[model samples]
Target chain A: MLRRKQFWFAIMAILPTFAIFGWVRLFPIIETLRLSMHEWNLLSKNKPFVGFQNFIELFSDNQFMDALTNTAVIAFGAMAVTIPMSMVLAAIIYHRTRSRFSGFYETAVFIPHVVSLVPAAMAWKWIFDAKLGPLNAIIMGLGGDALPWLFDPVLSVICIIFLVSWQTLGYGVLIYLVGFRNLPKSVFEAAQLDGANGFQSFLYMSVPLLKPITLYVSVVTLISGFNVYAQAYVLASDTQGAPGRQVRVLVLDMLENSFQNFRVGYAAAEAVILLSIVLLLTMIQFGLLRGKGGR
Target chain B: MSAKARARRTNFLLDVTLFVICILLLTPLILLIANGFKTPQEMLVWPPTLFPKDPTLENFHKVFTETPLLQWMLNSFLFALLSTVAIVATSALAGYIVGKFPFRAINIIFILFLATAIIPFEVYMIPLYFQVKALGLLNSVGGLLVGYLVMSFGIFLIRQNVIASIPDELLEAARIDGAGELWIFWYVVLPLLRGPLAALAVLAFFQAWTAFAWPIIVMTRKKSFTIEVGLANFQSAYTVDLSLLSAASAAVMVPSVLAFVLLRRNFVEGIAASGMKE
Candidate 1:
């Protein structure tokens, strides 16, 4: 009876957390899946069940396809540049510096990560603002014509990618620095005895050994990239992914459908799709990590 | 040249390069702060001066007097404080039971927590909004707080920390001394969990502080707006007031940035732990 009581007590201890998760998180997720199959706006009295119609419309819809592609481009594009650049930066800071200023370097790089995204986006918007913006002023001073940073379709996408990379680069560098710090010093010493130059050793040994950290960073970045909303929303001035929807990521697209257009069913379908992609990437990350014998 | 001389030259070059990169990375932030002090006329100058020609405190004064900046800051603080405390308390209790206790349903419960961490907010955002609205939480701070309370990440973080740090022998000794489970948990486990709990608090506080999308959906009233949402509205409302916008952004960013600088080590460790661990 005492043992049974202990078990019940343990269950009771954890029940509040489970209740919160079930009601707020798990139930909403399941409800999202359910809502994806029905046609219901916020004002609608009746949610008519329309099986697979929303999902079917998603593929045929041009805006959804654009948002999907934009998400991929931004996520993949940002990660591609951010991972390698951060690795190189981390290597420089970790391998080269033996002074006290290294701490300053890490903190400087990390400031962006700690700041709120909305403010950072506001700062970026100011930097990218035309006419009276500082960036264009510099270009005009240099005798170059003022280029549209956020107004052009291609440039808007580039600006979004740049903003994401700028915010995330510091995080990548810090993680890679941890990875570098954890590496065995003896291996580098041995490599030095073999006459391996700094460049050669870094290219062959440091890069390969840091594969797990790289994959981990890439996956985290990838997930955040797909969920990119606030930055685009803040920077674009027009929240509907301005410049002909060139930078409209999945989240923004879903928001527009649900709140602006009142297509809650269609937005739920978009949400379900994003959820699948996130789950798939998560699975791939686990598989890769497990193949490397687990962290 | 001698090997030592060559090495010295290389190190000097690397230092210069890293210094330049640091400056470049910090320039935008520096500009943000610098422009906050400039007058509106100075902000409009072509090939804008790096330093304000005439720096003034009027913009900051105007932001406080003209806008609901303080109320928004208080709202943000309340949200962050309540969310952090709740997350730390619930995560510690649930994590202790899940991490230390050997119960039959523990694995399923732990898995459920981990599963929620993988699903990004965007995925269930619409449904969550509707759910909160149905509960009459829309446009209310309590409603805003409810969504943040389901912190699976915090639970996992605390659970991992407990499993790794706390020893079973200690709990066993307490049990042998006739200490009740709740008593042992209160006096022993909670005290030992101070380090991880502090780290989790920093993480949760920052997460709640910087939250944008959810607060935008729920906090429709001006009085209920968090600092971040208020900053966004301030931008749209005063589009031509560059000085005011810069000042507002700086004001909104100060708290989180200050917290990070103060708890630098814990913030980095917590962030690294979240990413590196499964």
Candidate 2:
């Protein structure tokens, strides 16, 4: 009786979490997979199975291809810029500061991260505003033409990438700063004894030592890159990636299809593809990290 | 120059450079606040000044008097607080059971929870919306709350904390003293979980507070809008009112930043811990 009662209590404790997860996460995932193979306008009574027809159409669709390419570019682009920038900043802060004031710098950089993306997007929008924004204001004042920051497709993609990098830079810096602080002091002393200079020490010692952290940060940055929606949405002003759909990422594309175009089945198919990409990237990262650990 | 003097000069240069970088990082945020105080005519100048020539509180006053800003703030607060409380309660109970109790099925349950972390919101956005609609929670705070309640990371965080910090021997001693499992958890394990719980609360609050996309979808009614959704809507409606927009954005961002300031250490440590573990 005692053992049975304890077992029942444990089950009860786990049930709420299980129920929520089952209803919200697991069921949606399964339904998305099932819906991916069918055609439904979300208004009809029937969702007829199309048997990979949606997948075949998605592969051939030009917009889906553009979204996929844009997502890859932003994901890899943001990580490429953010990781190095954060490493350098983290190195400077770690090496330079000797007082409690270092906390102020960390907090300052991190303020943008905690702030909502909508306001941050709006702030960036203001900065990049054609006539009134500071960037173009400076350009025009210097006897140059005012550039189209968000009007040009390429420039708009760059702007979106810049916004993401700015928001996430602080997070990367904090993580790398922790990595720097936890490094053994003896390793630096040994490098000095071997007559290695600062740049050489950083190149040879610090970079290699921080590889795991770099990988971790890259994985997170990559996943967030694939999940980019609100920044693009706000920056593009909800025109379904204005200026010829140059900045349309997967999520934005999926959302536009489901809500605007009402292509529920096709959008569900897109969602499945995105999920696979995220899962594959994550698995590859884990495999690489584990492989490194094995040696 | 002496070596020590050269080193001191180098350190000074480094500090100046870092300070300059910090100022550069802070320029956009400062501009946001500065523009909020400027008059409409002043905002249209050739080269925008970093400082408003005539600083006034009229824009903030207008935002308060004109829009439903306070209602949105109230909605945001209620959602964040309710979600944070629910997450803490659920995570603590589930984490304790899975971490402390030696149940045979614990690993499978724990894995099931962690699996949700791998899937981003985009993957299930459509179906989840349908589910919310089916449950008749569309445009309701209850819908939003239900969506946020299953934080996989929070459960995992608390579980790791409990297993690592709270020893099994402690629970065993409580049991030997004629305490029930509920009492042991309530009086013993719960107290030891204060640190992780606080960290989880801050994380949960930020997630709920800054949430954008789903809130935009589910809260279709204007009266049910959260601060983020409200700000987005406001921006779309009044594109030219830079002052009012800036004031509203500042109003929305201050609370989360303030919460972060008060709990800065926990926030940093929690992020660092999670980052390193992965």
Candidate 3:
């Protein structure tokens, strides 16, 4: 009787959380899947089921294609920059744990992670400004031409990639540092005994040993990179328009389709694509981590 | 040189390199703060000064007097504080039960909760917007919070913390001593769950505080905007007012930056733990 009562109590306890989770998160996801197949505007009473018509239209749509391509490039680009840089930085920090400035170093690196995104992006936008920004000023001082950071088509995407990597680098470092701490000391000691140097041990052992951490960090960085919106939005959002290119990204495209353009179903299709990419990456991450652990 | 001296010299070189890297890493942030105090005229000066040529608080003054910044900050605070409370409460209650209980379906429920973390907010945010709108919550603070009230990550983190920290024997003893389940939970478990709960609360608050995308969609009216959304809108309105923009961004950033610095441990541990478990 007591056990049964406790079980009921447990159910009641979790009921609200499950309900909120299902309604707020799970239900919307399922509805987005269903909505992807149908055509509906915000005002329409009926959503006409159009099968894969929206998906087919999206493939042909220049804007959607551009957005998809930009988002992919940004995601992969950020992941590439973030993983190697953060790992090396984390290794540096991890080894210097005895230093008093270690805490300062960690906090300094991690501040960007916690700093509000819009402002951070804004700050970077200022830094990347072509004429008046310091970045170009320094480049010119170094005798390089002051390349347009936010205006040029290619440079604009690179700017976004830089911004995305900047925000994610701190997070990747923090996680990698944790992975470093958790790594066994004996392995490193053995490596030293075998006459392997610090860099070599790090190259041979730490890199491979930290595969799961790398996978986790890359997955996180890539997912957030794919979800890139506000960074691009804030960077190129100058209204008086002194040469800023509004780089089309997936979330921005979906928002435009949904709110600005009022193609709910079409946006839903884009959402589905974004969903598939994220879920696919997450599955791969879990699979890789599981494979490593199982071994 | 002696081997120890050589080692010391290398350590000093490494420290210098790390310092340079940290400065580079923090340059944008440094620029945000330094430029916040610059006059508009000074901002456009050639050889853009790192420290304001003549620092002034006029931009900050103008932001408060000229814009709905105070209202937006209030909105942001309400959203962050209320949502933090909601997430912590819901996550704790559910985490405790799911973490401690041995009910037949509990494992599946726990897995389901964890699984939701994999679904990026971008995937479901559209339908969530529609749902919020359908409920007549558009342009309201309540609508802004509907999406943030429960974080799947918090559920997982709190559950892990609970399982690791709280033993079953304490709860079983409380139950045997004729304590009601609710009372035992309130008295026994909550105190023990304080450390993780605090971490979850801080993380949730930071997430809500820095939230942009959802708030921008939900709170369209200037008066209804959170600080982040307001700051963005402020930028468009004052296109050339770079100083004012920097000041506004600085104001928005300071609290979060301060909080992170103060609660550095919780933030780091929370992020690290989340990364490890995932």
lDDT of 3 by residue, B21-117 (tens): 9999998988998999999899999889999978998989988898888889999999999999999999889888888887877778888888878
**How far off is residue A191 in model 1, in Å?**
0.6
lDDT of 3 at B8: 84
Cα deviation of A111, candidate 1, in Å: 0.6
The best-first sequence of candidates by DockQ reads 3, 1, 2
Question: Which segments of candidate 2 are over 4 A away from where they belong?
Answer: A1-5, A238-246
**Candidate 2 lDDT by residue in tens digits, B134-238:** 999998899988678778888888888998999878877877788998888899999999998988888888889989878988998889999989888786566
Worst 10 residues of 3 chain B by lDDT: B231-240
Higher-DockQ candidate of 1 and 3: 3
The root-mean-square deviation over C-alpha atoms between each candidate and the true structure, in angstroms, is 2.0, 2.0, 1.5
lDDT of 2 at B143: 90
- Which regions of candidate 1 deviate over 4 angstroms? A238-246, A292-295
Best by DockQ: 3
Top of the candidates by TM-score: 3
Error of 2 at A294 (Å): 5.9
